[model samples]
Target: MNANVLRYSAFTTDPAGGNPAGVVLDARGMPEADMQRIAAEVGYSETAFLLPREDGTFEVRYFSPLAEVPFCGHATIAATVAHAEANGAGEKVLHTRAGRVRVQVDEQFTATLTSVEPRMAPLDPDDLDRLLAVLRWHRDELDPALAPAVAYAGAWHPIIAVSTRDRLARLDYDFDALSGLMAQRGWTTLNLIWRADADTFHARNPFPPGGVVEDPATGAAAAALGAYLAHNEALPADRVFRVHQGDDLGRPSRIGVTVPEDPREGIRVSGTAVRITDAANQAG
Candidate 1:
């Protein structure tokens, strides 16, 4: 197994500010067990393993510390950036477990991933109550405009919009309880958010199911948020927004989101990634 993993932080240019993801540019002979073990050893929220195909497209898989997830946005960004850095910037088609993902890397090395067709589902009231209980949040604390729902781009994320930024900042929750509930419901993360304005938002994601307490920047969740906003008819004129995350964790990240006019089209998530050097990793 000649798996060479490169570390990169997505959603930020600074290595220490965004979410770190392990990228294996080539994993031709690597087994699934080895991928899972490598992910665990990397100790990041997620790691991306790419197997290059004969036709230029790549087959990709994402593994967290605990299990394999269908897709991961941050890892995708990190992996593609790492690929662009080595092979020069351009487009790549990724065959993920969820669906086909089209990623484009600009000359400046900013990677934008267009997710597979997004969908939204109603959040069962009983399930919402259980989730709130585990999160230690009251019903009144939620934002009235953005109703809670399960949104899926590649993975399922429950979109919970809080009324205040302070509420979003205070993110203490029952780890075991939330993890059990997420596993039962097949949710990747809880997309807890606060709308700063029409075009600005603040987000915090709890990823207990991935064996991580929180995700500094979550591209999948950002895509889900775009879907949620479009579904609720709450999107701005241009249907574009910026999401600021990881402030509470001290590793700030910025994610750009674009929702298409047609509901059938997938959401577009754009971000930059920086390679994590040995010194930077040690400092972090």
Candidate 2:
């Protein structure tokens, strides 16, 4: 019944920074309930459970403290890096609840995940109203350029682009109300973002359903965002975009997003991971 639980924080070299996740190297023999309990005990935003297949690919499941998620970006990054550190860096295929994900780990401890095909849909007017109310934000605060929409890579996230960085910095939400709305809409997080420049953005994610108030570095949301930008032709194709998150939470993380010309290849979300020490683990 024992499983190897490796702790790694993705999106930053410093263990104290970025988003921390637990990786279960061998979840083959474990039951669903066992995986849930382990994830709850680990108490990170998410933990990845891997069951290797005969073809060298693996079935990957992600569980948060409260429930299972179809996919999780930070956990994928952390788990892939942890796997590479132990098994050598190379391409790995993961069969997630969302779909197939291809990850490449380099020698430098950086892992990049190619998301499933991404898409965006218009947000329901009433749902958007409720979300804005819960966040205590006015319609005028939203950026007119980036309209409200539900974007999906592996999971669905509602993209709410704020007009100013200050609006994004002040993140206060009605947890119960937002959680209720998210549960109803099958949303993983509310991607709150502010466009600082063409290539740089400031963002925050409210994941009340996952039992986390906010995520420091959200790889799923980043992929969705990249898709949104590319789909709308918002940014120059040759440019690299940066997403800065966790600064408000003090864990400050940076996510690098690259959008190639081929839209079907999915966006590239790259980040580094660091091992957490005992003291840091205790504190978290």
Candidate 3:
């Protein structure tokens, strides 16, 4: 209960933008219940707890207000930046429930996390139907170029690509229904996206299972999205793209993704994080 938690916003230099996350630099003996309580108190989309090991690696856990997640991208970035500010900018390996995640922090406070080996699976027809129904979206609105699928890179996300940006902007969904469906399917968030161009995309994530209505910036989903684009062969020539998220919510976050040619390799998600001071926190 007396843990020293630092607040940070990831994917944006401004405190008002991006996704806010709580970072517990040292939670060596904290119980799972305490972590959950702290996460709820923080009231962010997610919080990260780090327990250091003898080998210098850290065993990390991510928690939302409702439950624990296998992995969380924004929290990882925020924690890494906080760690870098305290220690020094360098690389660190995080042992998460999903898998080992390698993270690097630069002098500029930019952090890049390499996701676990990503994979994609076909979405069940019945599940897709239910999902679309809950979101009040029809099949005709979907983008045929990017087939719907469940993509995983440290966490599982259902990728739903819409044809137009306007369709993606109007995000009105049945919260309770979507929550039940996500919980039953063990999905972390629904990655709703629309391709702006060959290298630019817009995303909105619905995280009902986490007790969050929507996530302004979702790093894990961005990694999963990279895998989805690669699997569908929809990547541009460079296999790099920018994800613009949180604009609808007025947060305005930017996430950079780099997809490797090797399907078995991890995707690289890069972004900057800024510490949320007491005044900034109060303002937010």
Candidate 4:
């Protein structure tokens, strides 16, 4: 089956910023191998393939350069905006590998994804130690308020909250070592964060699992962080948080997060998308 692939950056209005994703408008009859090949050929961290549904929604699948993921926030954001433009901006239901996700595009072009139910689990001490060593970080650098844990919102990420922004900025890690650990633990990425205030945060994601050193804007990890914050009651109910990410990578990105009172419903992450120049549409 021939599929058309489009590129767009999610969570930022700038064409050069945010997380870039490949979107397939029609993916009917495409095999897994073809999808994987297309994603790798596109060379984006993740690519989205949409299977249009009869009810005006679509079935979406996410593939990284290396493999398929359960769900991808940035890709979903990108796909939603693309769909809205091709179709119309409104509510769309996405059936993903992880679960059902509902995306809504506002009049201002901000796409918000209401995640699936999120959960968190304590990380084993040994795993945390190994991860810290891989990043060449000492245990003392960790924020006491935010304990290290494994959080999940469609994908699993090891959350490490740093006490200072400087510590988060200097993000150098042993890629091979960290990648090995993530592979062993089945982790999707490492969510490194610096809290700017009770309602604002700065984040960086090490996505060795996706064969990428860093993700410019990570919507899945942002959703996971929002779940963590709400579980701990770290922020007020009326607060709407902002996450600044990808600054150190030169592709500055901003993610908006809102934590509702209900813990059962997943977090809401909003961002705009901008279409960049069509890359040589090289689909394998």
Candidate 5:
């Protein structure tokens, strides 16, 4: 690829772990088709292309190998850290298809992104039933305390909480069925979760809509989970929680999420990223 495609692993400091994303720091004037092509060539779950504006802000677009997505949290973090390493670490606004996302880059190059206003919606019973059947999960396996619902924070993800951590670890689902249902509902991912306590949880994300079987680390889903916990009063107000993911897939990652007192405010999802010096490296 002729584009200056940089690779970075998000949510983990080690390149061997976390989700890998492609970042095109200067993609101004490039056609959308070209950006999509680069993302396809890179073969990551998602890639970010940034168009710098005169106001020092960026108009960002995210593309998976198969299609364009409204938002991608991992890609946002990877791109911001790459920019901070070159420019200075601070804050900036990114205009995405979902909304304006505010990002802060610390001196350590850990990027924290505040999502757009989040909202939750009830999942249709029929659809939820079908999803459960596809995942081979029985109704008894669900956690009644955490109702299944769809949550959005820049991107839409269906939140499904299981009864046990063992159930969360054994994730095998029908890709076609899940992908068809997700595409019909415009869902970016299925946020499958298991809560260990008030402040600790484990998660897995199925992103077949992005042509990936599963994502090692999903920041967007983590943000939606935080909003869900807040909306349901499942946790204390103004709390920060930890999400452990991808351990079953051998790409262990950790994500931290904070919910504010205000219900309408965006959830903050923060994590560190490691730069993959070679663009040819495997990520995600």
Candidate 6:
């Protein structure tokens, strides 16, 4: 095993409750192929590689077991927390393929990533129709008040708002179909959401493009959703909310997002991460 390779679960205090990510803090000399191979060997949904810069910044890259992705939220959170634990908590700038992301970690090991400027686009009616069929959802299942759209906050995701928690719980989907559509549209994940209240939401993400059925905690998607809701005036003036995800997968996770008054600015996604012990991996 690579000594530099560390395992951490993001978005939860318990190592077994959040999204597992392999974090390589000193991957400066590693080749792209080696990083990919290591990510595959780690067998997590995603792994983060950090190449330190002379200016104290980092050139970060994310990879799944099957392919490389532009940005990954869970991996970023995990990596920052791991770094803070080893080197002391502070701020770090990550230069990702998508954009530059600013992250800060406090002494408590809570990490927050501020996404790039968020943008929203309309989800084509034709695509929405097809997506619903693949996901076994009907038009009536959608929340009429919460409009669906494609939002980008470091990464692109289709923000879908369902009407009921029951509708969101049944997550069976046509993996191949959804993955193909997302690939063609260049989306990272399908942010399937159900608004729980004025300040709470339930979400599930389909990440077949990364060879994973679902992402337990997706901070990028949460950030995007915050922007989406804020721009549409759908959220409260406070623009703070908590998202519950991964319950159906038995690895429950929570993500907190704060949307600023300026919609074009970055959104803040905060969560806790814990180092995963080998014993926990063996138990799973």
Which candidate ranks first by lDDT, i.e. highest?
Answer: 3
Runs off by more than 4 Å, candidate 6: 1-3, 279-284
| lDDT per residue (tens digit) for residues 1-284 in model 3 | 58887899999999999999999999999999999998888889999999999999999999999899999999999999999999999998999999999999999989999999999999999999999999999999999988899999989999999999999999999999999999899999999999999999999999999999999999999999999999888999999999999999999999999998995779999999998886223201
Q: Candidate 3: minimum summed lDDT over ten consecutive residues — where?
A: 275-284
> Taking the tens digit of each residue's C-alpha lDDT, what string does model 1 give over 167-260?
8888899999999999999999999999999999999999999999999999999999999999899999999999999989989999999998
On a 0 to 100 scale, what is the lDDT of residue 33 in model 6?
A: 87
lDDT by residue for model 6 (133-177), tens: 989999999999998899999889998899999999988999999
Candidate 4: pairs in clash:
none
Deviation (Å) of 142 in candidate 6 = 0.5
Stretches > 4 Å off in candidate 5: 281-284
Ranking by lDDT: 3, 1, 5, 2, 6, 4
Residue 87, model 2: Cα distance from true site in angstroms? 0.8
Model 5, residue 145: distance off in Å is: 1.2
Q: How does candidate 2 fare on TM-score?
A: 0.96
Tens-place lDDT digits, model 5, residues 1-284:
36888899999999889999999888888888898888898999999999999999999999999999999999999999999998999997899999999999999999999999998999999989999988999989999899999999989899999999999989999999999999999999999999998798999999999999999999999999988999898975448999998888888889989888884789999999989875564322
Q: Work out how many backbone clashes candidate 2 has.
A: 0
Residue 35 deviation, candidate 1, in Å?
Answer: 0.4
What is the RMSD of candidate 3? 2.1
Local error of candidate 3 at 78, Å? 0.3
Per-candidate count of clashing residue pairs (backbone under 3 Å)? 0, 0, 0, 0, 1, 0
Q: C-alpha displacement of 6 in model 6, angstroms? A: 0.7
RMSD (CA, Å), candidate 4 to true, equals: 1.2
- In candidate 2, what are the lDDT values of residues 15-38, reduced to their tens digit? 889999998876887898888887
* Cα lDDT listed for each candidate: 0.93, 0.90, 0.94, 0.90, 0.91, 0.90
lDDT of 3: 0.94
Q: With candidate 1 superimposed using the best TM-score fit, by how many Å does residue 173's alpha carbon deviate from the native? A: 0.3
State TM-scores per candidate.
0.97, 0.96, 0.97, 0.97, 0.97, 0.96
